[model samples]
Target: MTQLIDPFARAISYLRVSVTDRCDFRCTYCMSENMTFLPKADLLSLEELDRLCTTFIRMGVQKLRITGGEPLVRKGILTFFEAMSRHLGTGALKELTLTTNGSQLTKFAEPLAALGIKRINVSLDTLDPAKFAQITRWGRLPQVLDGIAAAKAAGLRVKINAVALKGFNEDELFSLTDWCAANDHDLTFIEVMPMGDDMGSATRLDQYWPLKDLRARLAERFALTDLTEQTGGPARYVRLAETGQKIGFITPLTHNFCESCNRVRLTCTGELYMCLGQEDMADLRAPLRANPEDAGLEQAIRAAIARKPKGHDFDYSRQKVAGKIGGQMTRHMSHTGG
Candidate 1:
């Protein structure tokens, strides 16, 4: 049996594939309001994505995650889900999940659940309707609320990812946990990391709120216990000491757990990024267009993994410098399959 293992001996079994570089919301942390989206022609076709998944599955990838600027908005996504549902039934894929903004989730939840997609991660920062609109620029909180409920009704395990920005929504930590506990969903607090070509946002780095301090602050109200049950993602889980509500922390800046990194990201443009925090990437599009054969694409994947950086090189401890786009944090989280 074949397995994806980097030189560091980490077995890579998960793959995140971005289907589009377009989003409906102008998330303050994800992209600017004046964002220019990638041309429709640049995106990989549904067939190309399906082919890539087949090759990775053959290589022993156990899990597949569908991500995008907003995956559901991408055309022909339902068709892709239909294809993956077939794989799920046959056990060709061990697990299938998605990370979405929950914009169109209400409409797709039942169909997705029927397809055997058991889990989903939704990006939601604030529970306050006004704050939600403020953070997302023009997001309607009611829509997301309804979508989340629809997902729950469809029996899909839901996880929430909230970026712990200092001034933004830091105070809502406990409130978010309370909501998660009530909903029986897991919540992950991710430290805001510098990503993308927009090095111009100086105060964005100031929003970086380390998990340690966050825990210390939140612990005053809630006790947390370490949880080790696998959900097939990088975040470390800790159940709220009292409510048994799970809370995860993805701290790439303060403390990066890169040694256990076991995943690769494929952008919508068909580039395989070996490390999320690093710029080490392979142009799968050029090779796929030229060769389109399984063996050729498989070789391309293996070659890219061969040179996958040992770990990401991000330094957030230093003073926040304006307009400095260096290190592995050069790509936008939207394009990087976050």
Candidate 2:
């Protein structure tokens, strides 16, 4: 068994693969209302994706997370999930999960749970129907709520990921928390990162709400006990005394979780991004398409891992005003399959 160890000595055991860049909702912070998506021909075929993922698993990748603009929106995505379930059965892959918007969970929840996905992270910023529409642009609140119900009924552990927007979702913090607690779902709050140009730099700046502030506010209501639990992701966990629910904070800006970073992202087009905040990427599609034996593909991946950076440069303190963008990536969050 081969293991991928970066120059920084962090073993790369987690892989986030984007199945599609196309999303149904044009979230205000994720992308522009009118977005230009990658052509279908440019994306790696399902068979190619399965091969690439299997190659990584062979090299000791333990956890695989399927992401997209919205993974369920992709046509025939269940077949891919069904195929990956075999790795789980063999115990070679420790876990196979996905991050979704919860809109399509109503239709796919049962099948996903049957395919061996024990848990999933659903992106839900607001419980208010109007605010939900305002944030997600093209989303329907009732539809997502129903989908969540279906997912819960299917026995999938649901984790709600809410982006802490400055003025947008601030009022709903307690509401979101209470809802998650009542529903027996875990909740995680994420600070907005300066990623992509689809949402203007000014909007990113305006949307940037430090998790530090959000945590302080949360502390006012609930007694939070810090817990040193690592979920193989970049989130620091704390348990609330009142609800006994675990809340996670992904503070890329306020607190850097880079020193222990052990994951890499692969776009739908087969581009491997070693770091989310860094633009450097390795193109694995050429090798995968050129050689059927996967020798070239394996070499390309090892080389890419060797060049992984120690940390990402995502800082929001440089600019006090909204006009200037600071330390922001040029690619959209959806492009990298947030």
Candidate 3:
């Protein structure tokens, strides 16, 4: 098997693919309320996505994560999941998982679990109904809670991914931690990243709450034991001694976790983003659509992987210099399968 190794000698073993760019909710920090979505015609069909994914798997990708604006919102997405499960059965894929907003899990949990998806990440910022509604403009807290319940009932291990917004969720640190412990779910706190356009960037900068601060706050309330576990993602883990529940911190801004990066993101339109904080990308759709065989597609993927940067340029310290956010990508996080 051919292995994908970048200039930094990091093996690319994980791939996050976005099946669709359309999402049901217009998250404030992610995209605008009246966001412009890509046309369906521009998106690669399910079969095309499958082929692209298979190519990556053949090139030594073991972990496959399906992402989207909300991956479950895409029509006929289960079929894609079903198709990817064959790799798990054959032992070619180590895991098949997804990151969702937890809105559609009630409908997809069973099907996904049957397809060999053992765990998933849910993007939930707050437990307060009013605050949840305010953060996700179109989201209903009750519905998402119901969906999360359904996922748990369906035997899927759910991990809650909360963005550490400065003023938005500061008060919920203990509340959220206690809730996750009570529900028997792992929780991860992420720093708000500087991506997207002016409006979104402005909001992200204002919302930026460094994970260092959040961790310090958590340490005050709970005894956190540092963990050395890695799950093929950026989040570093810690275990709460009191509740015995695991907590993860993804500090992209405060700390750069790019040295051991082993993944690449594929957009719905078949664009491969080597680094999320940089604007550089490679278009694989043209080569993919031009031929049915895997030779050209494999070559294109390798070429893109070869150009992968050592680390993303996501820096918030530049704001101290001239009141400017540095290393901000022009595309929205949703567009890059966040």
TM-score of 1: 0.96
TM-scores of the candidates in the order shown: 0.96, 0.97, 0.97
User: What 10-residue stretch in candidate 3 is worst by lDDT?
Assistant: 317-326
Put down candidate 2 lDDT per residue, 7-111, tens digits, no spaces.
999999999999999888988878888999888999999999999999999988999999998999888999999889999999999999999999899999999
Put down candidate 1 lDDT per residue, 77-107, tens digits, no spaces. 9999887767777787888889999989889
Best by lDDT: 2
Q: Rank the candidates by lDDT, best first.
A: 2, 3, 1
> Tens-digit lDDT track for model 3 on 249-325?
99888788999999999999999999887888999999999988879988999999999999988877664323445
Local distance difference test scores for all models: 0.83, 0.92, 0.90
Error of 1 at 295 (Å): 1.5
Superposition error at 312 for model 1 (Å): 0.7
In candidate 2, which residue pairs get closer than 3 Å at backbone N, Cα or C atoms, i.e. clash? 196-331
Candidate 3 has an lDDT of 0.90
lDDT computed for candidate 1: 0.83
